[model samples]
Target: MPLSSTQPPTSTMELASPMQVLPSELLIEIFVFCTYNDAFFPLTLGSVCKLWRETVEFSPRIWQRISMADEGSIIRSRFLARTWASKSKPLPFDVDINAECADMILPLLAPLLPSISRWRHFTLTGEREEERTLLVSEEPATPCTDLVINFADYDSDDDETEGRATFTRQYPTSDRYTMTVWVHEIPASTILMPLDFTNLTIFECVFTGQHTHPLAVIDFLSVCPQLEAFYFWGWTHEDASLTTAPPTVHLPNLKTMTLKSTCMTRSLLTSIHAPSLTQLYLAHLNVDFQLPPYYSEDGDSEDEANDPSQSPSSDHATGMGLRTFLSRSRPALRVLEMDFSDMRTKDFRFVFSRLDVLEEFLIVASDMSDKVINLLKPYESCDSPVRVRLPNLKKLALYNCQRLSGDAIVEAVSARAEYTDANASSKLQTVSQVEVVDCEGFTSRHGQTLAKTLGNRLRLH
Candidate 1:
């Protein structure tokens, strides 16, 4: 009879490989490393053989991530659901589901609903209100710490879209009640959610409609006192209505803010008190630098203040609003970015002078005239006590600054590096990195000089 093919070779020349004889624990560890690149990856290795399948099936970490969507049929979804149920429970569950794939996911996920407290992150997007309601219904007791909601409302009658989003989380009475909402709109709509906001830290709202009541945004923020970051983006025509000055909402922990609007930014900035703010980004395309009357002592009417025919050079009003905001908040701001094509030289100086602790400053597609460069350059007064602007500045980036000259750029960098106090201590720290992108006047010669001062820290393109 022929020797059994499955049997290990008896001779010393041939023997069973060490891999085949590896312990179950070691094999499972090797499997985990093999599947680390993708989520729900062990499922691929589990199909090789009976022993390997059992090994993968028993590993909980290998099945911690459940990333599934419809595969064109209910039969496939049902099989996938069964597979998830049979595998180990992935703590801090992460899930992403949309309206189209909800039907297949809901039933499969029904069995895991009792353990909703394990969920840490989730994203839900839907096309209809009913779909959103159903999705929330299955997630009544989620302990999710981070969430994202995107909804699209499309009607057959018209080409435009109107959407409504609603998210409700039912926690199992825990102390950690903080949850963040990241909101955006592609098709226009309103977002509605019911949750405790005392512990919330971040709010990112993007408006796409002609108007979203400023009160609506304020109402949501008013309840979240612990909010740390906020972002708003909309177009010029989508003007927000603030009939009167809104109540000042204090966000003690807020550290970052990005606002993109025409006339609404004035009211929004004035109505918030963020003492911890360190980063501020502003983008406005409107010609008139009209701020809310609440900020102006003269109390000008909105129409007069918002006149578009006014020259963009009249940016003092806008600059004053920002300066007042900084003075009130008194935040140790480290980063300041702006997209101001016509920002006044004096206004820029006033703003820069206040940020004594600024570390990173970026000017994008803005005026970089000799006057602006002089304001940024560090200098000691000959008649009075010594002083420096942006003493802590380390990273200076100027993008598309057409008016900046190579000599001026070199002078600015060298001044910071050479600044010293009467006691010989460095008063103003030198910039370790300077990035000049598309600044036509800053030629290779300018870069060569900067490289000598900043060495490899100079990045020019």
Candidate 2:
């Protein structure tokens, strides 16, 4: 019956099955790559779909790192609790409390005290007195592993002379893995507070005043057995009224140190020792304090000759403390940076020898004095077949050096190459590259001249 009526089959297209979906592991990886804002990532991802929300809820690692804006304390607490309830893995959390909103914000975080054990990275800035007091008392629900408290704003108020004292007395002691404190523009009384935490690895104290005592800081560091880095920035006054001297404290585990002072003397530099230090930074130092081996019978005569304006008791010296510190720790140091352009040329020569193992040397000299240039010049010529042994050097940076000419700088670097080759016994290795950055007085032509002089040895950035 259909022979005459047989028609071509309808042109219907076949439908393909849904594309194979990615494994949950792959999705989680994608989430991890996208994971950033502690507060926003979880909330935003939760809103995408039921499946994604479930995946995020179950991924504790994703929720472990939380950074809530001071404005979103309420949301942070609620989200945090829910994440915990979902059986997500426990991870480190970073909570940044806003300094301006600290008063209003402290109350919100108080309720989360029970869950504090979940915190691994706790950052508190501009914290209110009551809030800090409360946090110091709350038993960690989860042991905090890393804590960073910045009290730079303690001196932000005109009437807050007691801010440092309050912070020192009330600073929270955590059983965390590492702790760092940065205190600026505070008085000595604040600096005198004892740091009792034994587990701390990194500690920094920066004070700006005419009377900052380095001794107080040194004493505080001596108590910590696990300390790995210590930094001090002290500003002293010309008047001798401030009697507190920097303490001579030694931390055997310390690997990095930075010290800057407007009035530090040579003796202060020689007293401190940290045998394991790998990086050192010094700035705004005085070089005249490095006293000569001999002086006239009349001490007053020598004092007057050095500087009539400076009192006999005034401590001044170039690289005195640095030289002392390096003499003990230079063997381990890999990075060395000095901003001593404000210092005299005599200090550079005194300090250069200490940086024999330094792989990265950054110098911001006040001027390229002839002494400094000569000291920096390679002891040999470019034609010499011997290679310089800056054995570990990968990068060398010179900044804000106005007195050195491009040609002079190149010659000095070439000499370094020569010195390395000449001294077969020396491990001094030739630097793979030299970088000159942010030198206002240096022109592009100067850079070109350096490139030409050093040949392939120089890299200008």
Candidate 3:
């Protein structure tokens, strides 16, 4: 019954064959998905066979996305450097320095800086003073296109101020294309470096303490002709501070801008013109204005009016610079979020009139007031509405506001929907949905009322 010697084995008696190997292209594709965290996988693959090591070594796409930290030891680092040099391809790399082992790691990285012209994203973190000195040294590799400098802290005793000052002074002279600098527990004065990023598209500067003259920062921003996004964070005091208004600096290509601190005056906002801005985020601002208490003509009193503390005041208030800013650059704004948690009710109403074409409006307040909610309600009216029109609005979110009743909110939304459907000239009504979040006293009654009013056009979360 055994098969003949010249005959092939019968199908039933045949031995199983190995699966076909994946093509080299497919293996490279899989390697592309691997990140710095999975670097060991590639390293292990390269060591498996001569062909795999050759494939991994010559693939610039593979080495381009590598993290310098992936090489575990000095020997490994040197090996990686040699591999990178042999490939000689521009690599998009991210170098993250391990703060715990920076002293041992930095020297290894020093040699690779010369080839950093390929870098698209670079992040460095270590002991504050040590990392700053290392970064500012004359031997920095060619300035990268996108750079992020981060400071590492252990016990918070590091002299962050001095470190940041040194970095600021050194950074302006570097030929970096785009940069973001983040400093923790450092004052603005520590940023003594000149701002000379003429080709920068995105810039973010964060500090803890108030600057005597924030205009210096503004002056630095003035040099960037192509800057697109700018963010500023800090605290400012009124006394003995340089309050000179910044000259109007036009950011024609700017798409987003954010400012977070205490209250900012109208003059400050008006000074920066971003013709292409689509999104704006303002937080913890104080605007000095207040609303009058409701008084019934019949001598009957509402509970709120009976309490003197409930009456809003605008005496100490200042105007938001948003109004003047929008008057000139209103055509491009599509999304606006303003958090006036520190401002009085009267101030919110004045600023609300400035967001003319807002499609997404998010307002966060400290307390919900009937008057303030009523002031906002007219934007939804099908008939006479507020000065600011949101014809394209699709989503509106109100947070921490206690004054608006759920019923009132639903009614306003319904009116707005009706108005848009009937009056919109384009035949397709723009607004289709609305949302509200984290209102303090919102309940089932409010939810039901809102649903009934908005019908299919509303969602609650």
Candidate 4:
């Protein structure tokens, strides 16, 4: 990292450069920005001039971030790691190495990986299982504020792929290194149980296949009691032989939750009591619309395939679980979005009966019908917001609601739009926007009626 003899000696260095005249603090920042103490900075910046050379020699904070990506030779990378760590002493290290051979690089980093001070950011992204061992086998002395691990070869374009699990601390203190690792297989352990889940404000986990059990996920949510936003995408159904009730956990701080196609969808909703939840998005929760007209919403049929909402597997909590979670949490939900759901009308009724404070409701590819739309028909002459069915409901959007008719939706919107307060003041629950998309029965006449009533607030597609 020394200046080569090719450059003139320090005493005869160029004198009129702006960089040479700038304050040492600004110059050091520029150095840190040029390279986060990578292999190139020392040789490049140190050889820039005598002032730059002295600055690099003296700044430890500038060497704080030691990161490398895709090095051809692991041996050369290891040498750089040791040198960077040695230079970044007395400062917390943020070492990120994204390479095919990252599993081997960790051992070379040694005690730095485990130092409580080095708990700044340790991360991996979708590699082999050997890299997953880094998640906990050499656990840090203290749990880091931020840790990201992807246990699948996740592709954003593919919905079937296993997704990433991210655990990030809302307030990260750079007192130590942070570890973020992405491994291809879920670690064989109890998913790093020893780490402190309380530090996480946002926790996301994906169970795309049968490799992860429901209990592990349940146990995981139980520890993150302070989570503000939780996302779960489980695709596997329980084995028929493994029927058991999953324990529920109360997430008092959780405000937003998104659940996607999964058998444990109901179990998770049934198990978690998120009283503070305000935004709820459920997608493909129940995927069957082939039931007979006489079939009961209770799913009393002996054949399981007839009712996709009915879990023939060990997941005893049926589609009713969605209703249960909503009614129980009783959070003043502001946004409720359900996509590709085949949930019964009664489930919709349950939600409508409970969430009077809902401001926006978007249902896509749902089994919503005329009866469901009729549920939003609040009295036209109500002088108070409290008397309305959905007093806070202002935005209504229906997408691919095959069973819904334009007349029912238009009637609902017209009835709900009448503020009609005795004080001549608009009620807070009045309909402000209505969007109807891909509903075959939603004709142009319905669009005109709603357009006259809602003006630009009406969106017909």
Please name the candidate that would achieve the greatest TM-score relative to the true structure: 4
**Candidate 4 lDDT, 1-461, residue by residue in tens:** 99997989887884877866889999887888877436357657778777777888788766666665544654565566666667776566565645453333333343343343443454443232112112221333454434333344344424532342222333354333344444333332232223333222212344433334555556656655656776666553433112444566888877888877655565577678988889988776653322112213343224322323332222223346666677667788989888865455555555676786788989887655687788787643556443456667878889987778888888877766754222223434566778899888888988998788788888876
Candidate 1 C-alpha lDDT tens digits along 1-461: 88788876779557777767999888877876775466556767878878878888777756655554544544454455445544645434544444443223333333343444554445455532222212222334543333222222233312432232223443444422232222332211122223223233222233323334555556656645655667666454434535566777778878887766554565666677888999988766344434333434332223222322233422444454476577678889998887652355555676788888898988776654766777765556976565667877888888877777878888876766656222233546666778988888889888888787777888887
- Score every model by TM-score: 0.56, 0.50, 0.51, 0.57
Error of 2 at 263 (Å): 2.9
The per-prediction CA RMSD against the true structure, in angstroms, equals 16.8, 18.8, 18.8, 14.1
Cα distance off (Å), candidate 4, residue 429: 1.7
Which number leads on lDDT?
4
- lDDT per residue for candidate 2 within 75-184, as digits (tens), equals 55545544543444445444444444432332333333334545444545454331232232234344222323333444454355334321221225643233233344
**What TM-score would you give candidate 3 relative to the actual structure?**
0.51
By lDDT rank, best first, the candidates go 4, 1, 3, 2
Clashes of 3: 8
Assess candidate 2 and give its TM-score to the true structure: 0.50
Off by over 4 Å in 1: 1-127, 130-208, 213-215, 238-245, 284-318, 340-342, 381-384, 420-427
Task: Estimate every model's Cα lDDT from 0 to 1.
Answer: 0.57, 0.50, 0.51, 0.58
Kindly indicate the candidate among 1 and 4 with the higher TM-score.
4
Candidate 1 C-alpha error for residue 155, in Å = 5.3
Candidate closer to the true structure by lDDT (higher is better), 2 or 4 = 4
Error of 2 at 346 (Å): 3.5
Candidate 1's TM-score reads 0.56
Lowest-lDDT window of 10 residues in candidate 1? 186-195
Q: How big is the positional error of residue 150 in model 3, measured in Å on the Cα after superposition?
A: 8.3
